[model samples]
Target: MLLGSDVRRMLPPPAMGRFGDLLAATTSDTSGLADDMSGDRDANAKLIEAFRQGVEQPI
Candidate 1:
């Protein structure tokens, strides 16, 4: 996720008008998603799902 964010940040200036609008929309969507979350519930759910999937195997 951090890598994805970094790549988005590194994208060069938008070329066409539509491309600029797309970039703006994507940024707004990301900001909205982050702001829509309330507390640790979202974080906890993510962690739980990760563990359930065995992606982050128990230590």
Candidate 2:
């Protein structure tokens, strides 16, 4: 996600290492890092509420 903003949230952590050894062979950056991830509670809540509203729009 660019600048901690994404259309979707991150996937499950344990579900990432599908390739096992193959994945370990490569240097990856998407390690669910705290610094890269957003910790802004207010902004996150707003985004979540917006998503909920968008979903409810069709209903």
Candidate 3:
């Protein structure tokens, strides 16, 4: 998902406060989820699952 990484790149400034924090979907490493968007169907599934799990976590 280049789109997903692009969206993260577009997160608002922290001047936006908690909403900014909520929208900032970055991993610890700046490389991002797009790096994982390779390989077969199973790989994509794994990434989607990981993203789902991350989304379910508290901001």
Question: Which candidate number has the best lDDT?
Answer: 3
Compared with the true structure, what per-residue lDDT tens digits does model 3 show for residues 1-59?
44434444454545334533443454334535545667675575556546544543433
TM-score of each predicted structure versus truth:
0.27, 0.34, 0.34
What local lDDT score does residue 5 receive in model 1, on the 0 to 100 scale? 38
Clashes of each: 0, 0, 0
Tens digit of per-residue lDDT, candidate 2, span 1-59: 23122212242334433433333332233332323438875565555445434422322
lDDT of 1 by residue, 3-58 (tens): 33344345554533354455445445344543455767568445434433332122
Point out where model 2 deviates above 4 Å: 1-37
- For each candidate in turn, give its C-alpha RMSD to the true structure in angstroms: 11.8, 11.7, 10.6
- The whole-model lDDT of each prediction reads 0.43, 0.37, 0.48
> Model 2, 52: alpha-carbon shift in Å?
0.0
Q: What is residue 10's positional error in candidate 3, in angstroms?
A: 10
Clashes of 3: 0
Candidate 1 ranges with C-alpha deviation above 4 Å: 1-39, 55-59
Model 2, global lDDT: 0.37
Pairwise lDDT winner, candidates 1 and 2: 1
